[model samples]
Target: MKKIVRLISAVICFFQLNVQAEEPKEYTFAINSAVTPLLHAAFINETIKTVERSVAPAKLKVLYVELPELERLIENHQTDFFISTAATIRRYQDLGARDVLTASSPFSKNPNRSEGSLFIVKEGRSDINSISDLKDKRAAAGRPTAFGMYLAAMGEIAADGYDPKTFFKSTQFYGLNRDQIIKDVLDGKADVGILRACYLEDAVNRKVVTTDQLKFINLKNDPEHICLHSTRLYPNWSFGSNPSVPPAVLSAVAAGLIAQKPVGIGLYWSVASDFTAIDNLLKSLQLGSYQRFSKEWFWQRIIEYRFWVLGTLAAFALLLIHSFIVSRTVNIRTQELKESLKRESQSFHEAQEAHRRLMKMQRAAVVGQISSLIAHELNQPLAGIKLYARTLQRAKDSGTLTEDKLGTALAEIRTDADLAAAIVERVRSYAKGARSERVSSEVSELVNKAVREFKRQSGERVEVKLTQAQPVHVIVNPLEFELVIINLLRNAAQALQELGVSNPKVDLTIRRSDNSAMITIEDNGHIEKETIAKLSEPTNSTKADGLGLGLQIVRSIIENHGGKISFSQATSGGLRVEIRLPVQEETK
Candidate 1:
């Protein structure tokens, strides 16, 4: 039985070798700094697992290169797969590298495509509270070319009141690898070290550094991820493949990376990496990481730095010239403004007096025009009172009055007196010329009330139509709104009566928009163009015996309520007046 088992194993190994020969004979992958050591280890492990599943021993080669070298390798077809920061992926694509998969660290997983730089130190070290404390102390950073590592550290060093170069007794680039720099800091080879955020995970797992020994210093807690990080974070590395490779190979590689533990990197796959911000950073740094800076700009900067002192002096001289020109222009304008102000101040008092006189005249004009209507309005309830009294006397004389009949008579008497009091109150208020008391009131109610009052007073032959988009509640003076509507309707009714139109019509409409309310009152009458023009003009009455004061009063009331009024010809041969008022914002 043992011999048979050994033979079967031997047969399986031979077939696997034969199958591996049939598969793609060769393939290579690239690794860089942003990819953690664990990811690298996992990728190799998963690759082996994938080969086993496929029943083949396909030989896979791995190449570890710094970010810049990786770019050259992919473009040259020296590697089949490349891993880089998202920014680098765009740079590589522009440089002829194909993007396949985006790699993520388990520590900084989904939704966060890139990690920032972290400044770690021994926990109990009091000598270094911040980057500034690193003065005269040795500092180590992972790869000067690795933007996240050094750029972030430099910014912190500057912010902590220390120049990155002058702040340290000695600063050195600790190889283009994170693990090496982490070890250097842990082994006491460096006083300060900057590492990518996720690199600490590996050091902790490997027992190379403990949380207590390595402390993250000057940690920034930022919203918008702009934490007061001792160092800024650049975009995370991307898992990509070389486009020069066959599509089949790219598919297999992408599939392998995406599959769970496909080769040995943890469960990580392609995700969208927005590197626009990082690109902006790289453009500022002028790093040759990409063609973001053209050769012309690079040479121009090189020349400028050579003569920076002279250039700065020249720029200062031009600034002074601009300042002198602006100062002269401002002085000239100031004098002209002073002269204009003197002339305007002489007319301010005159303007105020004229405004007061005009308001008084307007009030008198409205009172005259509505005198008959006001008398009629009051006469209605008084006449009802007289009729009710006569009926009550007749009933009492006929000996038909009972307790219920007397109660009814008293209630009718009270209603007639109340009606008379309201008409007097409205007239008195209008004559007082006091500003309308504004509050939130339903527009439809105000319009309907005005129509009812007009019909009661005039009893003119007219058709009234009221339409509202919705029950519009506006911040307004109830009295003022009612007054305006009444004036508009009365004007419309008068125009119809004058035209001798028996079936005259008045239409009231209210429209509500996002920020304002519009009220329109339209009438069907054969009004001449001259009459329409004179409607709103003060003292320009179109009626032979009319005061021409109704519309003017309406305009005043609406304007006082923070509104505007205008008149236009309706499409069906009539006058249309529209009033717009701002809707006060609702209190939360």
Candidate 2:
């Protein structure tokens, strides 16, 4: 029986080795159906025939898959090759998939910038003008995360300094039915529709929908581009291979795609070199490959351990007190037994106050150290409340307090209060050692809010101007980010006030520097270059009552956001503080 089993095992091993050594006779290709309707059965069959003929002696099998299943298939290396839209090409690359050739659809002459989005509103609708106008409006798109239909339009909203996640009041993520979205928009089923750029032109050309029926929001002014796009253009569909595919197979496949003529109504493949446009788009929206950076994972983990850290700190403090008590009791008991009962009792009670103040001093010092940092949290918001109250009083006295004005002021006040509370909660979270949360926030908006509050406080004492800016996004905790800006603005305002220039001006500028955002805050105020150099050493504050920690804290916060900050004396005798942060740039 043992000899028979051994023979069977040996036979199985031999077959396995032979299978491993032999070249594959067949390969499987997957098509993401959610990406395009072009990858139907006929197209897949045509592609398979061409690939198989090019790599002769090896057959190709094709399968259509939805986005979710497609991702899984590629992740598990269940498919040797795939076809996907440009939005997902980078995602697949992260999943160990490599693009061999780009599918240049017969629809567009420009394959690299072939795909984009159209924000469709009713022709008769007068309210919708731009992508931001779609906020709180009923909308139809293929899928919430679909590149052509949804994310592309949302990118416009984000570029305009608004949160895109909550743009639509109601979304009909009607999957794969691009035409249905348009139909729903026309029928008033949706207030707006998100559709692929060329699909509308195709519909109009085919007489399926008249050009007068739809209106595009935030229309691009690129006359050279064929499509009347509402968003920036991205690359077309792609041809990719799983990382597991042999290098030889990948090369053969690319050669086949590159060699193939326009087959099946001018369908063909073209090589694409620069996908920087698509990468910038994805980064701006914090989607696909940039999703990991968008998460506040660092702060989130700290929050989860917040209680444990706080508890540990408390336990350690208690342990210190317990050890001291034990030591004191032992010392006293060992020595005082030599004295009378009354004297011993008196000594123990007298020493009970931790030998009169040592315990009090140590415990108080530990607690004050912890609470000191938390004290700064409410300063900005409280100051805003006071400013608002003053503004309301002045507005009322001058008979300029309109209902809308009052409501706006009150709302701002409420928002500040909420932010103050959130800061408190965040401090608690940090104490528990929980990581803080960060999101892709519009830099202009954050800086603008800070400027507004600072201006309110300064009240014509210093002239503030935002002279230049670009649409840039950064992942940060919004409140903390705002506070950082507010602190800097306040510091600049203080310097300008002290300088006493007839036109004391604090000029703000923001722009893109490669993959980072460069923010410059300049004031016509003098500061010693030596002082600026030593600003990080914790002894740099010039103000007598200053804690001397403001700039250091600002630098630390900026560093935490994956950026650097520095101060320099400007040539004009003013202070120039520049902050650089990793950014997600927006396409103009």
Candidate 3:
């Protein structure tokens, strides 16, 4: 019975070994969808055949997934071996995968390396002649997660100072396929297209797109590679195994991939190449293994270098304090400047006020001087009126006066009284200052009135000759203007009287020149050059009893009325005064 039992055990153990041998080792192989479906299927078939030959009874389960899924599978330790680009392979390495081999193609100049992306546009598209022209243009690319074609294209664009996210107006990604991108560009649906390097060469060879229909953008001349590329080259796609995968399986898969012979497309695997260039590409783009630092990672780094972080914080605080101090200093200076300006403005206004007060006092003094002259002029008129009154009273008391004589004496008294009243009125007008009512007065009339008044006052001591072409009119205060002419005539009469010339004469001429009324008063009396030079100066006198304010007042009044006055030696050996006043238009 013991022998029979042992025989049963041995047969059962033999059957168990057979079952174990036939069950097959299941190995999940994950591949990123970096190529078209047809090529991916061929790659899968080739990979399966190579791995199955090296490790017998190995049932390789091929899983084609996008880059995200490939990464997930790697992180979850769900895949045994993965075939993907170097960028994705580096990500797998971070997830505890070991790179075993790299891919090589007949199209690659270096069998162990990969090439960059190709930027293409339609031929004759002059607006899109270069990579920089991609701004705001419609572009088509492969899958966004793709490394060789899409990420590589992003790196190239970023290197050229373009942000791939916003550089193009619109970007559409076709999953793991360049045919749609090429078609879109050709059909005018897209302005530019990006594909993995050597894609265009292969497409042209396959007759998918004609070389004449497309143009390479940012083409680099690499005689060694002899292929169109826009970015720097990186290591090719790699075959790698998960760290959880059995060492025996990893060894077998590595040997199988390296020994796999080139078949269709002359593609095969090579020994794993240095992925540092691929790492740099991903780092520059902040993609794959070198993705942007997460918040958790940032805090972790901060905790790792706490002393340096504290030092940076201290420096930042010091800089902030410095900025505050500078701001405070600037504000204090600005306030001080504002206060200084305020004080300067106050001082300027005080000076202006003082100057105005001084001008008022000077004007008052001039009016006082004119008052004294008026008082002196009134004294003779008053004395003559009193003398006439006394004579008339004496004549009436005598009772021997004839009717004609009595009438003549009364007339003389009336005339003397009228002259005294006129002198008082002149004094009142002069004392009233420069404010006078203005009206349109004829220059000829003003000149005749001034001459008649001068003759009445001086008893025709000087001959006055008046000449007028036409009736020239001017806007002026009649009283003030008449005062101006009277003062000039009075000065001329005095000058002639003092000279004692036999034929003392004053010639006054009035005419119109353009928009001005010209009045020329020429005297034949002798006047010194020094007297003429200072003729219009205030308080300057040619005569011992002269106030010297007459000519000065005349010039001031003429200038106040927008006229000019000038004194020159007359051709008649006397002083000549020219007054120009603006003429007023006559109304019909």
Candidate 4:
């Protein structure tokens, strides 16, 4: 009896092991050929990564299937899940396959249905002006069944008065690979080649073919061609889960695919794809048939007569109300326009008078600000002349008829006089009311020159620093840019003088980064927080001496150069002013 019991227990254990082995532990999925990029991104990378993170590294088999193979997989119940176009999913649903998730295509980001096909030829080839011209030309296509190559091309050809069966002399179809077709065209193996519309941009950007090597022809002008398109955009792809898939697994797959992101494609997720257009195309060509939805009629009746009638009536009412409102607005606008015309002439004259007075005030203020500097500049030459004259008198008094030495002394005197004349000339140049000169200048050189000139005139007490030493180049009106620097320096000098700082210093710094140039001036003047707040607020200077138009003019000049200025307190207890200027990219 004990032996018999042991035998039964062993048999029971063997049966239990068989049951566990037979349980389903693997799943299979197929990628629709149209959505290969998305397949690689989501399933191959993201889905497996997600499963690895949660469950142990169980090998998941993924199969790629074309449309026909996908249909067969469903018929034989070989696939656990599948991804396909919206129309195909609808057809499967009609044939009793339930949708678990909706699939989206790569081109679904752009809502405007713009798309088109291309007909390209080799460099300088002008024999073909239209698709009808391909009657006897050899053409190569990336994919014969591709929406762009076959459907879009056929639609264009039919419009151009040609039938696909007899239009071209010969046609060669390759699976979806553009590199092969491009190579074939470049080698003169094919008279014509076809590509998706925007596909050429990527090729040109990557230097696959020089722009001169390719010529595009026969673009359709439909609304669908006006927006994101290449060779007549067909509907996008659809993703769906298997009907036998558990809800939890279906939800997980949808979440995983939506979360997948690999570069180039921006924030992506599945959206409802409108395949009615593709369905219509297929029906027209009798390439495939779609079964009608059973509840489609119920929804169709509610929309056809009920929703559309109400919408039409509502739109008509809105149009009438809009017209009435517009008529009333037009009458009011006419009266307002007459009143505006009466005021325009008076306003123009007043504006001109104001502008004239403002210009006079500006000139007076600028002259006043530089009065001391101009006097100092003049005094240098006068002082030199005085010294030379004294020397000549001494030489004459002690001379033993030294004519050669006296002549040398006279030449020295003449040199000092010429130096005075040069100062006068510089003043004249500044005083003259002429347009500034425009020139191309290296940025580092300009900043260095400006700082040296400031230091030479203003004395050694002012410390200048050019923190950023990168060389930037620009085309600018030199006089205008120089004037801007001078004005800023003058303001900084005045700020230091007002604070009565002994080591009165102004620092000039230059910087270049990315696509811009920056010049900064820091002065050892303790500007109050309150004062700094009101600096750019158009407040006049608190000084009792002259008008505070220096900062205002500096702002205008920098703005004209496409630069901006900002003020802040320096860490070393002074005022800091930064000017940022944009660097223009040179075109080759």
Per-residue lDDT over 309-334 for candidate 1, one digit per residue giving the tens place of the 0 to 100 score: 67888899999999999999998879
User: Between prediction 2 and prediction 4, which has the larger TM-score?
Assistant: 2
- Best of the two (1, 3) by TM-score: 3
Q: What is the lDDT of residue 282 in candidate 2?
A: 78
lDDT score of residue 50 within candidate 1: 49
Local accuracy by lDDT, each model: 0.66, 0.74, 0.74, 0.61
lDDT of 3 by residue, 237-332 (tens): 777788866555565556556555666767677775567777777776666555536554577789999999999999999999999999999998
User: Mind sharing the TM-score for model 1?
Assistant: 0.43
The C-alpha TM-scores of every prediction are 0.43, 0.47, 0.45, 0.38
- Candidate 3: 10-residue stretch with minimal lDDT: 8-17
Error of 3 at 397 (Å): 99
Model 2 TM-score relative to the real fold:
0.47
Give the number of colliding residue pairs in candidate 1: 16
What lDDT tens digits, residue by residue, belong to model 4 across residues 486-518? 657766777787678888777777777677778
lDDT of 2 by residue, 101-148 (tens): 776665666677777888888898999887667779998898766788
Candidate 2 Cα errors over 4 Å, as ranges: 1-21, 34-44, 54-56, 205-208, 221-224, 296-588
